[model samples]
Target chain A: MEKRVTFRGWMLPLLLILPQVVISAVFFFYPAGQAIWQSLFIQDPFGLSARFVGIDNFTFLLSDPFYRASFVTTAVFSVLVTLCSMVPALFLAVLADRLIKGSGVYRTLLIWPYAVAPAVAGVLWLFMFNTRVGIISWYLGTLGYDWNYVLNGGEAMGLVVVASSWGRISYNFLFFFAALQAVPRSVIEAAAIDGARFWRRFFTIVLPLLSPTTFFLLVVNVVYAFFETFGVIHTITAGGPQQSTTILVYKVYADGFVGQDLGSSSAQSVILLLVVGLLTVIQFKFIEKRVHY
Target chain B: MRKSLIGALLASATVLSPLAAYAETEVQFWHAFTGRLGELVKAQVEEFNNSQSDYVVVESHKGNYSETLNAGIAGFRAREQPHILMVFEVGTATMMSAKGATKPVYEVMAESGATFDPNAYIGSVKGYYTSTDGEMLSLPFNSSTPVLWVNRDAFEAAGVDPDTDLSTWQKVGETLTALKAGGEECPLVTAWQSWIHLENFSAYHDVPFASKHNGFAGLDTELMLNGEAQVKHLSAMGEWARDGKFIYTGRRNEGGANFRSGECALFTESSAGYAGIKAEAEFDFDVRPLPYWDGVGNAPQNTIIGGASLWVLEGHDAEEYKGVGEFLAYLSSSDVQAKWHQDTGYLPITAEAGEATRAAGFYDENPGTDIAVIQMTAKEPTANSKGLRLGSFDQIRGIIDEELEAIWAGDKSAQEAMDSAKERGDTLLRRFETANN
Candidate 1:
C-alpha cells in the first residue's frame, strides 16, 4: 500500500505550496527570463541604448576557441575538486566512525575549514605559495627545487585545485560522517561475526549502504566545484598563465563585471544554466539508479 | 493626542534641518585610490570642501581601478552615478565609446564659465584623455610613466659601478647579467609587465602599437604589437628568463614587495612606486629613464602615461556641473598640482605645476625625481608614441599578459606568443567596435 498525505481540497494544496512557487518564480525564473532577453541585445556599459544583435553573442561565443577551451578546463577542475575533496572526506569519516573516544574533538576540528570563506581560503593558499616571498616556495627553493607557480601553468592549476578542494573536504566530511553513523551498527557486527575482515566488511556492506549519501555528495560537489570555486580561482590566479585555469564561470564574471561585455556574459550564463540543468537530469536518470536508498 | 502631536513636531523638525543645511550643493566624486594615494585624495577633497561654501565635494573610495569603473557603470544604470568618475588610462577607450553617458569636461568648463586652458596640461598626458577633435573629455589626474629603478647598494655590492649608463636595453641586459653573477636571487623584476615592457617599449622605440593612429583616428583599429621591435624586445626578455637572469613575479604589483624588500636588484615600475620605495626601502636607490632597444631607429622616444583621470558623467544638474568645474580648476591649480607632485611621485599634469615644483627646488631636493616628466616630454610624441586608445584594452591586456607569461615559462617563443596575443586581442577589438559603433 502507498502512504500519502491528502489535502481536503485543491485550494489547500495550492495555498500550502504557494510560498515555494512564488520564490522560485521571483528568484529563478525572473532572472533567467531577464538573462535570456538581455542576451539577445548588445548595449554599452551605461545601458542607455541597446541594439538587437539576435544570437550574435551566442554565435561568437561558440565559435571562439578560448570559450571552448574553458569547457575542458571546467570539466577537469570540477572532477579534480570532487575527487580530491570526497575521497579524503570519506576516509576521514570512516576513521572517525571507528573511533571510540575524542571523536567529537576530531569532528569539530575537521569542521573548522568549512567556516572559512572561499576568498579568504584563496588568500591563505596564495600567501603560502607565492612565487617570490612565499614560505613554502622558499623552503622548496632551499631543498634545491625551483618552485615558480607564477610562470608554470601546471603548478598554478595544482595550487588552485588544492585550495578550492581544501574547504570543501570539511563540508563533504560532515555529511559523510552523519551517514556513516546512521548506518546500522548491528549489521556491521553481524558481518564481522561471520568472519569478514574489516576491509571486506567495509567494501561489501558499509560501502553499499553509504551509496545514497555518496551520490548526493557527488552531485553537490560537482556543482560546488563548477560555480562556487570561482573565488578560489579569481583570488589565486586571475585566469592566466595562458588561460589554463579560466573556467566557464570565471569567464562569465570577467566578461560581465571586469570586461563589461554584458551581452556575451549573459549568453555565457544562459549556456551555463542549460549545462547544469542537463547534468542534473543525467545524474538523476542514470546515476540515481545505483543509489541504495 | 499629545504623543502623536509630539511625533509630528519631531518629524517636522527633522525635515526642516535638512532644508536649512541644503543650501550647499553636494558633488559626489568616486575614485579608485587607496593607501597613501587614497589619503592624498582625501586631503584634496577636504581642502576643496573647506575652500568655499558653494559646493561640497564628497569623495568616496570605490575599490580598485576595474571595480570603480564597474561601480560607475552600474550607478549610471541605476540612475545614481556620481558627478565625477576617475578612470584608469586603459579605460580611456571604454569611457570614450559611451557616447551619451559622459559629459565632456570642456563642455562643463565652458557652460559653467570656469577658467579652462587645454594647454595647461602636459601634452602626452592630455593626449590620452582628449577626443579626436581636440576636445578635453576628462581632467587628467595622477598621471605616471614607467621608469627604471636601480638598487644602488646591490650594484655596489656586485662590484658593478652604480653610475653605469642604462639608457639602452643592451646596457640594462649587461647590468642584469652582472647582477645575476653576483648571486643576486632576483636580478630584475617588473610591475605592470604589459604596460612597462610591451606598450612603453613600442612607444619608446617609435613603433606603432596599433593601427588607426593608435585608435585616435577611428574606432576600427587592429593591434600591431607583434611587430619586429616588440618581438625582439620580448625575445631578449625571454632569453633572460630562461637563463634565470630575470624573475617573473606576477602580472601586477606582486613584484613590488620583492623590489621593496631589497630582494630584487633592478625594478622596472611606475614612477608612483617612489612613495612606497622611499618609505620601505632601507638601501640606496636611483631612478632612471626607461631603457629602449638599441637596434630600433630613433629609439628612446617619449613613454606613455599609466595613471588615471577624472571624467564627469551626464544627468547631473547645472549647479553641480558648476561645482565640478570649480573643483577641477582648484585641483589643476599650480600650487595644488605642485604640492601633489611633491608629496606623491606622480607627474604634474600641468606645465606650470612642473615648473612650480622645480622653482620650489623639490626636484633638487630629490635627485632623479624629474626623470619621469623629462622622459615623457622628451619630444613631441609622434603618432606612434602618443599612447594607445584601443577599445576593450583592459581585456586585451589580459591576453597580452597570458601570452607574455607563456614566453616567461618557455612554453612559446616571443614571436608565437605576440602573434597569438594579436589574433586574440583583435577579436575583442572587433566586438568592442560592433557594440560601440
Candidate 2:
C-alpha cells in the first residue's frame, strides 16, 4: 500500500509554496515577460520614449546572417562542452570509486576546481595558451604547432570550450561519484562470481544503473553550456577571431550592453527563451525515456 | 529612563546633522578609472572638495569604460543618474543624441555663472565633444591619442638604430623587417587595433573612415573604411604578418603586456600607455608620432583623440548643477589640468594647461611625451580628420576587429575583410538611425 501525508487544508499547502512561487514570479516570470514585451518595441538609450514596431525586431534578427550563425555556434559549443566535461568526469569518478587508499585526497584534489569562478578559469587557461607568453603555446611552437588563438578561430573555440568545461568537470564528478557508490554491492559481487569480466559486468550492470544520473547530468550540462559559459567566453575570447565563438548568450550581451540595442537584444532573448523551453521539453520527451530509473 | 534618554539624544543628533549637511551641496561624479589613474582621480576630487566649503564633489570609480557607460545608462533608467558621468570617446554620439538626458557643458557653465570660454580648450580635443555649432557639449578630460611606442633596447638588440625615424609607414616596414631579420620575436604589436590602426590611421592620412564627414554631418552615414589606401596599408600588414614581422596579440592592448615586457621592438598604442610602461617596463622606451603612408593623399594629418570626457547628466537639483559647474571649472584650471596631463600622460585639454606644463619644462624633461599633443595640434582638423561621431560605433569597432583578425590570419584578403566589415557595420548604423532618429 502507498502512503502519503495529507495537508490539513489547501491554504496550508499554498502557504507552504508561497515563497517559491513569489520568487519565480518576481525573478523569472516578470523579467521574461518584460523582455517579451520590450521585444516588440524600439527605444533610445535614455529610455525617454519607445515606439512599438510589432515583429520588426524579430524579422530583422531572423534575416541577419550573423545571428543565424550564432545559433549553429551555440549548438556546437554546447555539444562539445557537455561531452568534454562529462566524459572526463565519468572516467575520474569510476577511478575514484575503485580506489581503496588515498581516495579522500584524490577526491578532494579533483573537486578543487569547482570552487574557481568561470572567469578565473578562463584567465587561467588564457595564461597557459596565450600566443605571446603562454607556456603551452611556447611548447606547442617548439613542436611546430604554432598555437595562436587570437588569430585562429578553431583554436579560440577549443580554448573557450576547454576552459568552460574544466570548471564543470568537478561538479559532474561529484554527482557521478556519488551515483557510482550507490550501486548495490551484491549485484556486482554476483556478477563477479558468474565469471563475468570486470568490463563486461560494469557495462551490463553498473552502466545501465547509472543511466538516470547520466541523464540528469546531460540536461544540466547542456543548460550550463548554453547559459553559464558567458564569463568564460567573455574573458577568453570575447567571442572573437571572426565571430566564430559568438554563442547566442554572448551575442545577446554584446548587442544589448555594448551595442545598446535594446529591441534587438530583447528579441534575441525571447528567441533564446523559446529555444531553451523547446530543448527542455525535448529532453524530457526523448532523452529521459532512456533512463533506467 | 535610559532608553528614553538615548532616543532623545539620537533625535537631537539627527536634527543637527541635517542642518549641517544642508549647508553644502553634494555633487556626484562617476568615472571609469582604476589603479594609478583611479588614485589620480581621487586626488583631483580631494583637491576640489578641499577648495570649497559650499559644495562637495563626491567621486566614485565605476568599472571600466563600457561597464561604466552601461551603469550610467541603467542608472538613468532608474532615475538615479550621477551628476557628472565620464563617457569614453566611442560613447560621444550616444550621449549627444540622448535629448533631454544631459545638460550641455556650455549651458551648465553659463547657467551657473562660472567663468567659461570654449576657445580655451584645444580644438582637436574639444572638437570630439562639441556640437555642430562649435558649442562645448561635454568637458574634455583625460584625452589621449595613439602614437608609436618604441622599445629602444629591443631596437638596439635588433641592430637597428634606436633613434631611427619612424615617420612613415615605409620606414616602419623597413625597421620591422630589420628587427625580424635580427632574430627579434615580435617586431611590432598594437593596442586598440581598430582605433589606432584604422580610425586614427584614416584621420592621420586625411581620409574619411566613414561618409558624411565621418558621421559628424549627418546620421545616415555609412562606413567608408574599405578605401584603396586602407586596403593597401592592410594588405602590407597582412603580408608582414605572414612573414612573422608583425605579431597579432589579442585585441585591446593585450599586446601592451608583450611591448612593456621588452619583447616587441615597436608598439603602436595609446599615449596613455606612458603610465603603464613607466611603471612596468625595465627597458628604455620612447613615444613618436603615428606613422603614415607616404603614398596616401597629403599624409600625416592631425590624429584624433581616444580618451574619455565628462558629460553632465540632467535631472539633478539646481544647487547640484552649480556644484558640478564649479567642479568642472576647478578640474579645467591650468594648474590642475597641467598636473593631470604630466602625471597621467593624458593630453592637456586646455591651451593654458599645455603652456603651463611647457613653462614647467615637463616636455623638456620627458622627451617624446609631447609627441601626442604635437601630433594632434599639428594642423586644424579637416572634415575627415575630426573624430568619428557615428552611432553604434562600438559595435562597428567589434565588427572591424573581427574582420581585421581574419586579415591577419590570412583567412581573407584585406579587400574582402574590409568590404564585409563595411556592409555588416552599415546595417547596425541603419538600425541605430531608425531607432534614434
Candidate 3:
C-alpha cells in the first residue's frame, strides 16, 4: 500500500507531464525564444548585421499597410471560416445522431475529407475550381454564375471560405458527433416522453450538453483557420486576383523569407501569436464558462 | 615456438605496410533543382568525385527557389548551413547584405588560386551578380528569361492564324479576344505574375521596375509598379479576367500544367519551361520572344532573367573551398555550359559557350532559342533596364500579386491596386532599410 501510494505521488506528475515538458522545450519554447531573440536584431546571411532595433520592428509593422491588411484578412478569415465550418458540422452531427439506418456510412463519408493533407487538399480544390476544366466551374456555368473567382472579390473570398471549410467540417463534425453520442440517452428519452419535440429536445438538452465540445472545436478551428490555411491560400490564390486572400501567416512568410525582412516578418508573427493567444484566453474565460463540462 | 612464429609474421606485415596520409574534406551544396535538373547536378558531382580523391561533395535539394532560400535561412539560424547554396535572382540583395554569412565568389577563387576569370562570363549575366564595383559575388547558373509559349494546335483549333504576330501586348490582347470569341475559354494564362508582368514588363519597356537601379543603389528605393504604363497594362489584364480571357492560377508556374496539356494557346512562362514543354508537350508548340507594350516605348527593349544561381556559403575548410572552386570551374566550362544551356533552355553564362552554341548551329536549328539572349542584350542595360535589387523582393512580389489579383477581380482598379501595393511594399522597404542599416 505504501509503495503504491509513493509511486502515485512521485511518478504521476512525471508520467503526465514528462512528454509535454520535453516537447514544449524542444519544439515550442526553443523556436519561440529564438524567434524573439532574432527579432531583436537584423540578420543578413553575409554574416548577421544585427543592430539592437528593440521594438522598432513592432512599431514599423504597425505603420505598414500590408501588415495591417494581413491582420484584417486573418481576423476576417478566422471568424468566417470558423462560423462556416461549425454551422454545417453541427447540423450534420445532429442529423447523424438522429439517424437509425446507414448513419455509420454517412458519418464515414462526411469524415473522409479530414484524412487529406492540406497540401493535397489545396491541389484538389485548385483543380475543382480551375477555370478551364474544374468540376465546380461546369456546375457554376450551368447555374449561370460566371464562376470567375479570379475576377470577383466576393467569389474569391467565398471560394477560400468554402475550400477551407471542406477539410475543417469533418474535424468539427467528429467532435460534435462524439459529444452528441455522450449525451444521456435516458434524459433525451425522458424529455421526449414529456412532450418535448425534436427542436425542443435538441435546444434544451442536446445543444447545451454538447456546448463543451463546440467551444473546444471553435477555438481549434479558429487557430486552424488562421495558421494552417496559408498553404491553401498560397496554392490557390497566392493572396490575389489582388491581395484579397493574403492572410497573416502568408504575410509573415513573404516578409521574412521572401522579403528578407526578418524584423517585419517577426513583427507580423508576434502580432499573430498575440491575437491567437488572446482569442484562446477569451475562449477559456467566456465561452468555456457556459460549457456543460 | 607458436608465439615466436606469430611475432615474426606481424613484424613482416608492419614493415610492408604504407601509411595513410590524408582525410577527405566534405562540402555541402544546397540546390533548388529537382527531377531532371536534380539528376544533372548529381551526375556532375559524381563526375567530380570520380575525377579526384581528396574531397567529397554532398548535394541536397533544399526545396524550390523560395523554399531553398528559406531552408538556407533556417539552416543558418541552426548553424547547420551548407557550404554552397542556390539563390534565385530576386534574392541578390538579401545575400549581399548577409556580409559575414557569405564569402564572395571572387575572394574565394582568389584565395583558392583557381583559374577564375569573371570576363569569361557574358556581360549581362555577370553584371547582375557583380557588386557595385563590378566584382562578381555569385556565379550565374541556370539563368533564363521569360518567353511566350504558343500552342499551335490550340491556335488552329480556334481557327485563328497559327503564325499570328504576337509581338505586342495589344496584339496578344486582340488575339485573346478572338480566341475567346471563337469559343476558346482558356486562351491566355501566365506563370510568375510579378516576374513576367511587372519585372520583365518594366525592363522590356525600358522603364524601371523599382527606382535606383531597381534598388541595387540603396535600400531607399520604392516600387514603381504604380506607374502610368504599369497601371494601363494591369487594367487591360483586369479587363481580360472579367471576360474570362485571362485565368490567374496560383503562383509558381501553376499554369504549367494547363499549357502543357495543350489547352492554352499562349503562355508567358520562364524559358526553362522549354525543357518540360519539349518532354511533355505532345502537340506542336513553339517558343517566341516575350511580347511587350508597343505603346509604352518606341518598341520593346529587353527581358530580365529568371531561374537561379549558385552562391558560395561561408564556414568551410580550405581544401573544401578548393573542391568548390574546381566544381564551379567545371560547371562553367564551355562544353558543360553549352550543353546545359541547350538542354534546359537557360542562358549560356559565358560568351564562349553562347558563341559555341551559335557556331554549332543549335540556335539556327531550334528557332526562338536566341530570343531570350537577344531580348536581354538588345541594348546596353540602363539603370532602369538593369535588374531590381530590392531587399525582400519576394515579399514585395507577393504584395504586387495580391494587388494585381484585386485588379483582376475588379474589386479595385489597376491604379488603386498598384497604389496599395506600393504603400504596402514601401513599408517593408523602409523596415528593411532600417534593419540593414
What is the iRMS for every candidate structure? 1.1, 0.9, 2.8
Q: Cα lDDT for residue A289, model 2?
A: 88
Strongest candidate by lDDT = 2
DockQ leader: 2
Judge candidate 3 at residue B145 and give its lDDT.
89
Give me the runs in candidate 2 sitting further than 4 Å from their true place: B1-23
Once model 3 is optimally superposed onto the true structure by TM-score, how far is the C-alpha of residue A86 displaced, in angstroms? 3.1
The candidate, 1 or 2, that scores higher on DockQ is 2
Give the alpha carbon lDDT tens digit for every residue of A1-293 in model 3: 45553454768878878999999999989888777876776655433666777887787777655557767877788889999999999999999988999999999999999988876787898889887689989898999977877656567777888888889999999989898999989999999999999999999898888888888888899999988987777777767655667788887876676666666566677778888899899989988878888
Full-model lDDT, candidate 1: 0.90
In candidate 2, list every pair of residues with a backbone clash: none
- Using TM-score as the yardstick, the better of models 1 and 2 is 1
Per-chain TM-score (chain B), model 3: 0.93
lDDT of 3 by residue, B30-108 (tens): 8898898888887777777777777667776766888898878776755667778899998888888778778899988
Error of 3 at A248 (Å): 2.6
- Give candidate 1's error at residue B427 in angstroms: 0.8
Q: What is the lDDT of candidate 3?
A: 0.81
- Candidate 1: TM-score? 0.96
Across residues A168-236, which tens digit of lDDT does each residue of candidate 1 receive?
A: 999999999999999998999999899999999999999999999999999999999889988999999
